[model samples]
Target: MSGPDRVAGRTALVTGAGNGLGRAIAHALSAAGARVILVGRTLGKLEAVAAELGGDSRVAACDTSQPAEVDELRAVLSDEDVSILVNNAGIAGPVRELVDVEPAEWDEVFAVNVRGVYLMCRAFLPAMIARGGGDVINVASVSGKRPLARRTPYTASKMAVLGLTITLAHEVGEHGVLVNCLSPGPVAGPRMARNFRLEAERTGVTSAEAERAFVSRAALPRMVTEEEVGAAAVAMLRMSGLTGADIDLSAGMIGR
Candidate 1:
């Protein structure tokens, strides 16, 4: 049970598995013996990750924002046994003031972050319930718990995810499905790098300076890693009795 044998018989569907936290979680689950289905908009990136993992790893190119694409993805997975579902695909757009943000951009953010999660759950949860039990992990953010200035779209979408997680957990608890959310703090991923660059442009500061300022807001004064978030996801999947819980993997940032 040292390697893939631990999760050998399990199947996992990870959205946004092309990079960042989703990629890390896919790798982790695969290492633990799960057959990972990597879903993302980029086939090349997903295939690259699948090749690296080997052994039952699959790539499904999907723009989660599109309902038809999501339905097709569900049809593609119709015959598979998926034990774990990680709703990790998301976007952190420009940090614009509420009034200054374009309406379309705001809608797009919710389309991916909120609607995508809902569609995935709708597509997979029935099978999971029929099979007796499964785990669903939503990758929310600290902003979901507290309001952050200049990121109305991202924050609002994450909040919606938190609500969805809670309701789904309650709905499926008796059926043996576990639904929970992990609110990660400022993790040093490509998204964070992009956010930093945007901040630099906004304030006329260097990217390095913006990153430093961003990290300073954290109580730990350091960014969390993808492996750390993956570990939390693994824990959630392994916990049979937990549901409707918001596990904060923020390195003690929320209360402070």
Candidate 2:
């Protein structure tokens, strides 16, 4: 089949766009002609990306976990008419056994992965439905599908996202809004590198060795790429008939 049509004239709000997959998605959307809004906590990083996108791009620096800040963000965007919302802001926090995990750490994970997406959807979905139709892509993880060894908080947060996506898809499908979760297996990005580094520190291995070990667990025996995930997000956004589905861009690891 031919590639999806360019999203020209559409406006997209991408959170966690300061780096990694979110940044890649923002670039892809901008290149596809969407008027992109880069949202993240770091103004300098967001501004740098905004500068690269050039046309009709804006940056909003707000911590997604804060409802008041999200409200301010909504007020700032009240007139922009956003047609796409990508809830990509997330945190892995510290890896620890569930029994040993602190309540505060769990809350932090939920704050960004679950609550942040909830806030973004609540703020943007109305405008999208009002404008006729739109796409909402929540960036989840393979951890959401099944438990990982020491990622209790991260896993829980992503599972919540998956549930949220399904629930919202049902609520908004008739209104022409598509909601879905994009679960990527270990993508080769800054975030993945950080995760690997943390694992290496915990396991007493070199970072390179740690990454190699982790990639070996994947069916493809290789790490996925940010561009690949970005492409999947584009595909999901264009899939008008698809909703409430967990799209796995996992490089053959889902069933394995």
Candidate 3:
């Protein structure tokens, strides 16, 4: 089975589905025949995505960083057979040096990027294990494995996600669950553009120059796209043999 056949009849819940990678993933999963659940902090944004999906797809509002909100969301989704869980909710912490980063800022980043993944897994993994199989895709970043200047909290949180994915896979392998993560490079989006602008301000260069410097490290010398990330998620679902793997969709950044 491939393409739509791979995910047909499955329910996929994607966090941060209002925009960026999450929105793209929701669209991809829906296109692949999965009943998608658009989850995010903004109800209006989710509703917009839900309308765009225009099918059995639905929207739910919840702050993944908050345990209470996650618990409430789990209860609301208790009746759905969510076989595919995409823990895509994350936040870019303060773009400043480690010393300048406030303690609360660091904690907030971990709350969404790390603790959010753990909470979602804890809420849904039992049912998946009981069902004898499931798929989990934790969205991480290449920055997790590399040294990114002035991104201490986001980098650290993503690295934690990588560890969580692999260790969780090991523990659930016997039960037939597959867990993996995508460590994408600098994707071409508003997020990256903002980062580029900030970098230009910090490094005394034009935005284009800052972007060039960032992508020059990659063998392909370009950022990935949101659609590409979505397609990668679909491909991961199709490949049953893959588990405990960190797929680097970074335009050969890791290779270089």
Candidate 4:
């Protein structure tokens, strides 16, 4: 796809670009003419994604949850004018009842999903503001706004992202920055497959049955694809006037 030209010359830094939705978003941004920077905890994975983009695309290894690592990452790319920041690095915490969740596990979830966003924005937003404008797209989830049994950590972290996106928009808009979030539903991928298997084991049902129940709850009766989520991110980037908004790319299941 020739993609949109709005971001053609911009540089976009996408955390978690090593795989899944993050990888998809990196590709979409590259195709839209942005010089993509693939950032993640795994060096090899990030390098692989950068190779795929095969241009001015670069790679940086950083565990966003770690403040030191994020600071170093900012230093590493200090020369690059990153006009877009995609905060997509995240992990699925253990799926279990709230009572069964460990405090450390809950902290781990918030560290990556919530604190990671805070650290990235803190590191990059000043530069963006100095340059006079930028775009930030935080990858949240539909589970944040809806009830998802046995996923308190993940859901709560995502809900925090929603709140962060809107309020951050309020704080940064005066500096010409646009901050928004994309809340995707069950995206068809290995991650969702693992979730299905876990749910099946917990509920004493087959994985297929678990998957069916999930998709069946959506108005479209299907899971959204990673590519769709990636495309949505690019679309959000192209919307120049949009800010403080949560775009639900949940296959019509958002309100259900």
The weakest ten consecutive residues by lDDT in model 3 span 1-10
Candidate 2 residue runs with Cα over 4 Å from true position:
1-6
- The backbone clash count of each candidate, in order, is 2, 0, 0, 0
TM-score of 4: 0.97
- Lowest-lDDT window of 10 residues in candidate 4? 1-10
| TM-score list, all predictions | 0.93, 0.94, 0.97, 0.97
On a 0 to 100 scale, what is the lDDT of residue 14 in model 4? 97
lDDT of 4 by residue, 1-256 (tens): 1234558889999999999999999999999889999999999999988888899899999999999999999999999998899999999999999999999999999999999999999999999899889999999999999899999999999999999999999999999999999999889999999999998988899999999998998889999998999999989888888899999988888873
Error of 1 at 85 (Å): 0.6
Clashing pairs in 4: none
Q: What is the C-alpha lDDT of each candidate?
A: 0.87, 0.87, 0.93, 0.93
lDDT of 1 by residue, 74-172 (tens): 899888888789999998865889999999999999999999999999889999899888889999999877867799999999999999999989999
